[model samples]
Target: MKILITGSTGQLSQALQTALAGEGKVLALGHKVMDLTKPMQIRQQVRLLRPDLIINAAAYTAVDPAQGDRDQAYAVNAIGPEVLAEEAAALGVPLIHYSTDYVFDGRKPEPYHEEDEPRPLSIYGASKLAGEQAIQAVGGQHLILRTSWVYSLHGRNFLLTMQRLLQERDTLSVVDDEVGAPTWAGTIAAVTADMVRKWRTGTGGPSGLYHLTATGETSWYGFACSIAQNLERQGLLRARLEPILSADYPTAAERPLNSRLNCARLQRDWGMVLPDWEAALHQCLGNANAHQANHSMQATQSL
Candidate 1:
């Protein structure tokens, strides 16, 4: 099958490329190739590609900056998916889109299920929620997978940010009040590929909103501490970690304190379960170490 995936250079897209390797023809388009903010461009590309499946990973993800730039966020995160759904309905193909856990107000004591009401706190979250609703309104076969605290080594994410700060500073502070699973991009990509494969084979269950995240949850401070401990074990760096409340570090956007999502529905329907956040983190760090070693060997060969 021919597949069209947006956000070509993003961490999730890169992982999707790897996961979908040899499965089918994948037309990966980045912002340079197809800007989500431009509906005509999106419509044109969909018409031209005429893909059997559309996986929209592209999004405007700047939480704080989104407060000042709601137009851009809504254009990419809301209008983009709406246009894609309309085109997909026209072509009679399924579209896979991603949402965020930020849609919730974080008031619930337990993990959020798909049926939970969404009350987004930040403009970024609101825009994403709007995209989900827009896609549903188009009356197309689509899957809106809601994930939380996603990070990976290949892109601008929490894991990479922690790595950089650990190297640069002897001390670091991270928010402890907010909690969520630090999902790996690779995990999302793999599960997405599985879903698409099953759907193509007429085995995939159904299309709807599902919470896709790691099995366990942790605060930003805990996540940073884990990364620091892992890096230190690899002889990378040693640093003093400090945990602070969310108010201690204010931002333009209000973040949800409880970003945890329950994935029981995903597992029941897809017959798949993701590893814990810590295990995924270990695998990511291992990959990073291997990449560094390869680079070092290449340098030595050049010398």
Candidate 2:
């Protein structure tokens, strides 16, 4: 299977590349090669590549910046996917897209299911929801995976941010009110590859939305603390951290208080199971440490 991964440089795309290394012929396209802001670029790229499967990992994820720059967000996150879906439908190729937990208002006391009605609170969420709608309306084979609190070893994510704060400051405060899963890109990518393999041999692709996230849940503050604990175990951090509320840490975009996603339906359909968040974090941090060690070794060799 010739698989095309968009947002080539993103954490998830990178992980997908690594996970699907021996699975198939993988082609990665980042913003530079295939700009989502320009729909024509996407259409042309798909025409040129003629890939069997396209995984749209690219999205405008700047939550706060999206408040003021809604046009750019809509262009990339909303209209861009719609263009890709149209192109994919034209070519009869399957599209695998990613959405967010932010599509919900986070008011429910339980984890959000795939059937839950989306009530996006921010422009970013609204744009992503629009993209999801477009993919459904395109009448093509597509797998829409909605995840939350994405983090990886080598990305600008909540885990890395907390690690930096711990290194730079003596104390840190994180929002405790918000709750979600700290999903690893590696897991999501692996599951995606599995799905691709199955789709290749199976009768047909599951053409609808699914929630793929780590098992268990945590607040932003809980997530930060877990990162600190893991780093401390690795002898990488030594700072005091405290938990606060969302009201204390204000942002232009309103975040959902409950971002947890139920993956039962996904498990039943895909036969994929997600590991616990802390285990995922530990593995990711170990990867980060290993990468740093390799880089340091290369620097010493050069010296």
Candidate 3:
């Protein structure tokens, strides 16, 4: 089977590329190759590639900046997915897309379920929600996976930012009220590959939106502290982090305080569950370390 994955260089796309490589012929495309903002280009690419499955790993992820740039965000997030859904439905293929916990307003204290009505708090969230609804409206064979707090060893994420700043700065402050699971990109990709295999074997559940995230939750401050502890253990710690409230740090866009998502439905249907946030983080760092060691060994061999 030929699998086409968008956002070739993105964090999740990178993970998906590695995970799905063994399952089929993976064709990953970057913005230069297939810009999500162009509907004609998407349609043309899909027609040309004629992939067995289309996994849209692309997204407009700038949360705060999206407030002032709604048009661009919608072009990539809302309209792009809508066109992809239409094309996938036309081709009679499945399209696996990723959404976010930001679709909610963060008012509810409990975890957001798949059935919960989304009330987005920012332009980015609204655009994502729009994309989800558009795909659903198309009545296509689609699986919209809603994830939260996605981070990886690569990419611009909270994990990398905190890691660098925690060593460079003498002190730092992170929000304590906003809470969610810090999902690892590798975890998402591995789980997605499992689901794809189940689908191929005719054991997968129905196509619909599902919450796929790490089991546990934590605040930004807590997550930062975890990273700090890891660095300190490696003798790289330098920052004295402080916990601050959300109100203390105002941004152009509002964020959902309760970004937690419930994953029981996914587990019940697909028998898919991810490791806890801490364990996933450990695995990411371990992979990075292993990768670096291998590169060093290769260099020494060449020498």
Q: What tens digits encode model 3's per-residue C-alpha lDDT throughout 1-303?
A: 999999999999999999998998999999988899999999999999999999999999999999999999999999999999999999999999999999999999999999999999999999999999999999879999999999997779999999999999998999999999999999999999999999999999999999999989999999999898888877999999999999999999999999999999999999996799999988888787689779999999999
What is the Cα root-mean-square deviation between model 3 and the actual structure? 1.2
Instruction: Give per-residue CA lDDT, model 2, range 112-144, as digits (tens).
Output: 999999999999999999999988998788989
Largest lDDT belongs to which candidate? Answer: 3
Residue-by-residue lDDT tens digits, candidate 1, 1-303:
899999999988989988987679999999987899999999999999999999999999999999999999999999999999999999999999999999999989999999999999999999999999999999879999999998988889998989888978888889999999999998999899889889988988788889999898899999999999987887877568999999999999999999999999999998877899999989888898899899999999999
In model 2, pairs of residues that clash are none
Residue 102 accuracy (lDDT) in model 1:
90
- Candidate 2 backbone clash number: 0
- How accurate locally is residue 250 in candidate 2, as Cα lDDT from 0 to 100? 90
Global Cα lDDT for candidate 1 = 0.93
The candidate, 2 or 3, that scores higher on TM-score is 3
Give Cα distance to truth, residue 47, candidate 2, Å.
0.9
lDDT: the better of candidates 1 and 2: 1
Give TM per candidate.
0.97, 0.95, 0.97
